[model samples]
Target: MSNLIPTGRTDIEWRNESTQKPPKAAVYPAEANADKILKAAYEHTATVWTGDFHNAKQVLAAMKKRVKRPSEKKRAGGGDAVAERSRNIQTAFHAHRMKQAQQSRILNMLAVEIGAGFTLDIPRAPDVKAALADVYGKPNDAPFLLPLNQLLGFIGAHEWHKKGVEIPALGGRIHVPFGVFSPLRGEYLDLIAAALAGSKFQTAFDIGTGSGIIAALLAKHGVPKITATDTNPRAVACACANFCRLDLDNIVIEKTDLFPAGCADLIVCNPPWLPAKPSSAVEAALYDPESRMLEGFLNGAAAHLNDGGEVWLVMSDLAEHLHLREQDFLPQCFQTASLEIAEVLQTRPKHAKAADENDPLAFARGREVTSLYRLKKAV
Candidate 1:
């Protein structure tokens, strides 16, 4: 939603309802009234304000103000709610700009494929740029020509990811990159963590570690040595950063197709089970064309696993529910890879999307079963 509110184009207006027209009070270059405007927003007051991207300093200042509360507890409690409301305001106020930003990203990536330079840099005000610059030790150079959509996405992630995601399963919060693929980190990550709870491996491999979440979990569970790999450079950089931030020096992240050279006592892969083409980099972790990643792990795993070691395959059966893949597809691949399943730990998805009747694949998502299949070399 960072792209939701692009600088300039004062045409953006926020009301309790989307259909509401721009108010006359919303005039560009208007005086900065951060206190009043923020007070009104907190009171659920509807006052449209229009300011060209040039005057975004005034606009963003008003938006960032704390929605004042009377009691100290209420003021301090649920800061997340306040942040959520701010995001809602941003999302609802400039929905069209976000779409435009996304379209720009898609076009940019496609253009880059055919030898186009990334020439688009979303214009940011001094305050906005400074806010982004605040997060350093990672990078603090002048802004480069990042794609409008992706840069905005990064900005949004910088703001929220700074808060970090609490994973009760791991007894910690995982800070992820702006646009990196984050496995919902609950059911799947926790399931795999739980399945390997009592086990202690001298060395472990986390295949396609997007955010290094799984590898970190394995490390926390007493894995002495862990090597993680990812095909995407962004994921590689992201996982590495998260590892440093989380003090998980024990986990080594590398940029590789699936697995690095040599072998380990445990090999873990959480492939995109569905067989389809990914529309974006973000979707790559969800859609595995012809199940290439999945198959790659199954086929290459045995060569890297130590004797009696197992490959942990974490995935969901939503593909079968949607008729995109057969129920026996995974097992068949295992057998084809000359691997035998040692144990199957399954859990039903409890996400809100599963209960949504409007989801096209509600029937499938509702009944989806995620499993961690422990596979070992067949005799």
Candidate 2:
């Protein structure tokens, strides 16, 4: 793989294992005594929270009082491995608390119970009908869950006078329906915004336009015409709703795998960065194992792009640190896709992973760089 491409020239770099000190905080995975954890959790009361979602609400409520707000705590001064073990326990406890919180939330939102099969007890509403139809496709009034989180978001958006959550980068909030991925929370949105700010676009297409954030930004940037697409039906509906909420109906959204139709002067894509299978639907926006979506975009870009037009592919090398991707994998992608790296616009991430020293992958995460690859069809 090293012979396939030289990495010395690129803006990205692999982990320097030698320079990194053995991480100060050590965690004993097995040393975590379940009995001790459970006793602490129940406050010596009955073990209402042992290890399942059945008592999730109770466990999470108890955890909230104990877990510190994900902090390092004034450096915690010096401590031996035991002290480090304590910190690790704290971190793990924090993670457990969070998992419980999520489980509780999901359990509470299971409006429709599943017993025998796919039966759902859906709440009837005007928008609910559309949401149900959007997810179920020609309702049988059968028992099926319609990605209620997004439906709830849609419902919430309608009830609230505001359009959506505010994005300082987009200069406003984008109403992200329950499932649609929010771009404002991460650096990619800001990086994409910065890259597009100095460039002029006559026509553009936003691939995988979750929540239509990029498409909306393009329209706001004064691009005359724009087209956006997503394979997820919920995302298609969500993006459309957000476009309407932002009053940018000019951006046409379609349900497609990667590309829509003819070429445009500029194309933008923000693929799932991780090369791992997502655990659930909402996680799809973040995890794309095997780089399926990323590869698809690169492989198909040459066909959809107009001559001299560039496809701005947003990427990050953090996956490299997590041992998820090979260092040369990205360059090999450009070569395989018959695309040339015209320019690499990169920024060291300000995200939590970069600042976290206690993280197991801190060495890699600390040096992670997020970049927008300005790629073009090879002539």
Measured with C-alpha atoms, the lDDT of residue 313 in candidate 2 is: 91
lDDT of 2 by residue, 187-243 (tens): 777777777777877889899998888898888878889999898877888888788
- Model 1, runs deviating above 4 Å: 1-126, 130-152
lDDT of 1 at 242: 77
* Best-fitting candidate, scored by TM-score: 1
Error of 2 at 58 (Å): 4.1
**Which portions of model 2 show Cα errors greater than 4 Å?**
1-58, 63-163, 358-361
TM-score per candidate: 0.65, 0.64
Q: Compute the lDDT of residue 25 as modeled in candidate 2.
A: 17
Model 1: per-residue lDDT, tens digit, 182-270? 65638887777778778968999999898888998898888999999997776887788778877888988888898899999999988
